[model samples]
Target chain A: MWQLFTQNWQDFLTGFWHTILSSIIALVFSFILGSGFAILETNPNKFWRGVAKVYVEIFRNIPLLVVTMFFYLVLPKVLPAMNGFTAGTIGLTLYTSAFIAETVRSGLQSVGTGQMEGCLANGLSYWQAMKNVILPQALKITIPPLGNQFINLIKNSSVLAFVAGMDLMYQGDVIASNTFQTIPTYIIVGIFYLILTLPLSYYMQYLEKKLA
Target chain B: MAIIDFKHVDKFYGGFHVLKDINFRVNGGEVVVIVGPSGSGKSTLIRTINGLERINDGSLIVDGKDMTDKSTNFNELRRDVGMVFQHFNLYANKTVLENIMLAPRIVLHRPEEENHKEAMRLLEEVNLVEKANSYPHQLSGGQQQRIAIARSLAMKPKVILFDEPTSALDPEMIQDVLDVMKLVAQEGITMVVVTHEMGFAREVGTRVVFLADGEILEDSDPKSFFDHPQTKRARQFLSKVISH
Candidate 1:
């Protein structure tokens, strides 16, 4: 294990950094997209609700590898050519957003219907009622589920490995192949993932407690 | 002029009729109390005034604007008519003060300083000035309902609807909410209250409306309605309610 570290520290560091960057970027974008779609799903208008439903169903049903591969192998043929990292991040964002949307929609529903009626009766427009009264309560209910979706998103960023996106898992595969030390190399990669995820899990628990 | 007028109104919940051929009018400064047994459609009748429940047939007018017209913006009409729910639906995320300040600031576009001042005044009216910064859950049921009342008052509405406001309160807490409501009534704000509290109906209401099976059986001054109820149902309901 020490030998693997000494031999390929630079590669491991670069992979770790890339993984962190991609996850952060995907996390932010997916949150925005997921929240938007969740709001759309909860909207009274049939058209917007249908659009959100279709988006969530399509992305959530497909496998993560398949989604990543489409962007990596299929998208470039239709649009401008994109690199592996960008493709993987986009795929990760879209895939995770579906789960997030579902979690958030449940949260919105958990808030009593009276909350919306109260705001409307107080002269708020529908959107205004949603933004001011409904969403705040919904967010509180969604935080625990949202945290799980985010943690899953970070782990799922490993899909980049299949496309040679140079993330931590990709580097682990490369190192294992070249050094023939598969078990140790993978162990190191697992440790790095724990390093990223454990704090997030603990933080989410803390947040849930504080909010409760 | 009447602040709210319902002419031959009918409302149906699918196959079940909720309100039937209701002809009701709330004149300015009149406190109208509606009393009925459970499932008698008292709530449905009051909710229609602010467009919370849409009437299936007939014309409904609020503040002189025809609520049945599709072009009439319900949000604008709601600005002049506020409602307090039986559940005391204060915003769970907001402080008591923010609950009062939100609609006025966002919907009315009241200047912040003016809005804040009015919110404080309203809070004082409800006797919750000390709890302005507290969240809804932190307050007791009576306090929460009072804050809800203050929130409705912040809009300075022409009419306020109270839908069984005291029904959810503790027996001990009921008086606090009723006191605030009584003050609101005395100030001449047109009020439509649906309640089981016979004392409030007789003392605070200018007129009492007796409803049964989706129709108004009696609409008369509180004295006549209580002392000389015309209908058998009204007499029976009054005896049962007043005895408790």
Candidate 2:
């Protein structure tokens, strides 16, 4: 493991940086998309609600790799061509967003009906009440679950490896094959994953305590 | 003119009739108290004034607009009406000052300086000025209710509805809330309150409406409603309530 890393240190660092960049992009986009869909799912308008439901159901039921392949292979044929990194990030964003939507919708429901009623009775328009009063409380309830989704998103970014997106896992596979040190290369990869996930997990626990 | 008027209002929850053929009017500056046993539609009735509860059949006029009309915007109408819930439905995420300042700033679009000044005044009115930065969960029940009152008052509503405002408080805490309510009543703001506190009703109510089986069984001055209680149900209700 030490020899592999020292010899291919540049390749490993490049892969790690790529993984970090892709994960950050996916995380931001997925949160915004997920929250938008969650609002639509809980909206009073039937059409918007149905649209959100279909998006969540379709993406959530499909495997992440299958979705990535569709974007990588199918999208280029119908539209403009795209690289593996872009395709994988889009796939990861959509897949993780579906689960996040459901988590956020449940959080929205957990807020008491009285909160919305109190806001409306105080003369807030529906959107105003939702943005100012309901969403804050709902987001508070969603933090723990949202943290889980983010951690899963980071792990799921590994799916980029199958598509040749040059992420940490792809680098691990390349280094293992080139160096023939399979166990240590994989162990190093796992340590990197833990480095990403453990801090998030602890932060989420701390946030839950602070909010409580 | 009546600030709130309900004419032949009917409300149903699925197959169950919640408010039946209700007809009443609340004029400007009058404090109307509604008293009834559990499930007698008192809360439902007051909620209709602000469009919180939609009436299945009837016309509800609030501040000269017909709430039952589809064209009437309830949000615009609600700007003139405020409600304080039994649970003190203060925005749990907001500080006491923020709770009072939110609607005025957002809905009414009041200037920030004026909004702050008025919010502080309302807080002072409710005697919770010291708890300005405190969250709802940090306060006692009576104190929370007082903050709720200040929040409602922040809107400068023409009418305020209190739905069992003091019922959720401890016996020792009830008087503090009632005292705040009494001061509000003395300010001559139009109020419709649903409560079991007959003492507050007799002391502050100009009119009392007794509800039972979803019907307005008695509507008279508090003195007559309490002392005379013409209907047998009214007599029984007053007897049971007063004996306790």
Candidate 3:
């Protein structure tokens, strides 16, 4: 195992880059989508809130692999032009967004009702209060949970491999199948995930401490 | 002329009537203290003036605007009728000075420097000038309540509401907050305070209102209300609290 790693270090490093890039893109896109849905859930209107609730439940309850597979295999048939990588990335974003929305919506709820009432009493419009006071505070409360969602998102990106999406796990699988170095290839892939997840954990811990 | 008029107002919380046939008038520069047993609707009545609690039936006129109407701009009314909560609600994330200056700078659109100066002056008035830079967590309950009063005063509001301001404070800290309130009453800002501090009520309140079971049992001058208690409910309540 040690000898194989020494020989294929370059290949593993290249695969590591692919994983990190995919995680970054998914993280950014998911956060944007998740925050939008969270705002929808916070809306006072019953119709919009129900719509947001339906979106969250549908995405979060279904298996991530199933969603990715549907996007990769079925989406191309429906759209006629969508490829595996695009479909997988899009699916990862939409799937992760559901959990992230739930996380952020709970965060927004945690910052006591008085904060909003105080802001409203101070003459801020509801949107202004949300933008300036409520969201800033909510962001602080949601960071740790959001960080957990992001790390899980990075690991979940491995589902792209089932669709031949060329993420780190996909490349590792191809390398192992060709070389028959199953354990070593997987060990390398696991290390790449650790490399991505560890830094992310530390970054979120830093944010939690800074905000505290 | 009365700046706030509650004409036969009725408020219900889903069939549990919290305020019934509440008729009252508060003229500009008058200080009214509302005293009652817990859940007697004194807080609800005061909250209705600023539209924090809506009246189910009848007219609530403040500053010549009908508050009972759905179109009435409660936020605008709140700007002129500032409120201090029992819990202080001092914007926990903000510093003492920020708590005071935020409303004037944001709501009134005052210049930053002018807002800061006025806030500092109010802090000095409350005897909390030294604690202006400290966060709410850093201050004692009395200090936080004083800052809350200063926050409301910074808007230069025509009227102010104190909802059980000292009820949440330590016994020793209550005096400090009451002193600031006494000064505010002297300054002639129309004040409606819900409190059990009978001494402060007698000292500062020109008029006193006694409420029981969501109705105004008595409303009269402090001397008459205290010395010649009219209702059996008022007599019972005063004996229960004031004797202690």
| TM-scores for candidates 1 onward, in order | 0.97, 0.96, 0.91
Here the TM-score of candidate 1's chain B is: 0.98
- Expressed as tens digits, the lDDT of each residue in B1-244 for candidate 3 is 8999999999999989999999999999999999999999988888888887788998889988899787888778888888888888777777889888877777788999888889888988999899989999899999999988888888888999999999998999999999999898888899999999999889899999999999998999999999999998899998999888
What TM-score does model 1 achieve against the real structure?
0.97
Higher-lDDT candidate among 1 and 2? 1
What proportion of the true contacts does each candidate reproduce?
0.82, 0.80, 0.37
- What is the Å distance of residue B210 in model 1 from its true position? 1.3
lDDT of 3: 0.87
Candidate 1 vs 3: which has more lDDT: 1
**Runs with alpha carbons beyond 4 Å of true place in candidate 1:** none
Q: What value does DockQ give for candidate 1?
A: 0.83
lDDT of 1 at A47: 100
Best by lDDT: 1
Model 2 Cα lDDT, one tens digit per residue, A1-212: 68777898887777788788889999999999999999999998999999999999999999999999999999999899888889999999999999999999999998888888889989999899889988999999999999999999999999999888989999989988988899998988888888999999999999989988
Task: Note the residue pairs that clash in candidate 1.
Answer: none
Alpha carbon deviation, residue A31, candidate 1 (Å): 1.0
Window of ten residues with lowest summed lDDT in model 2 chain A: A9-18
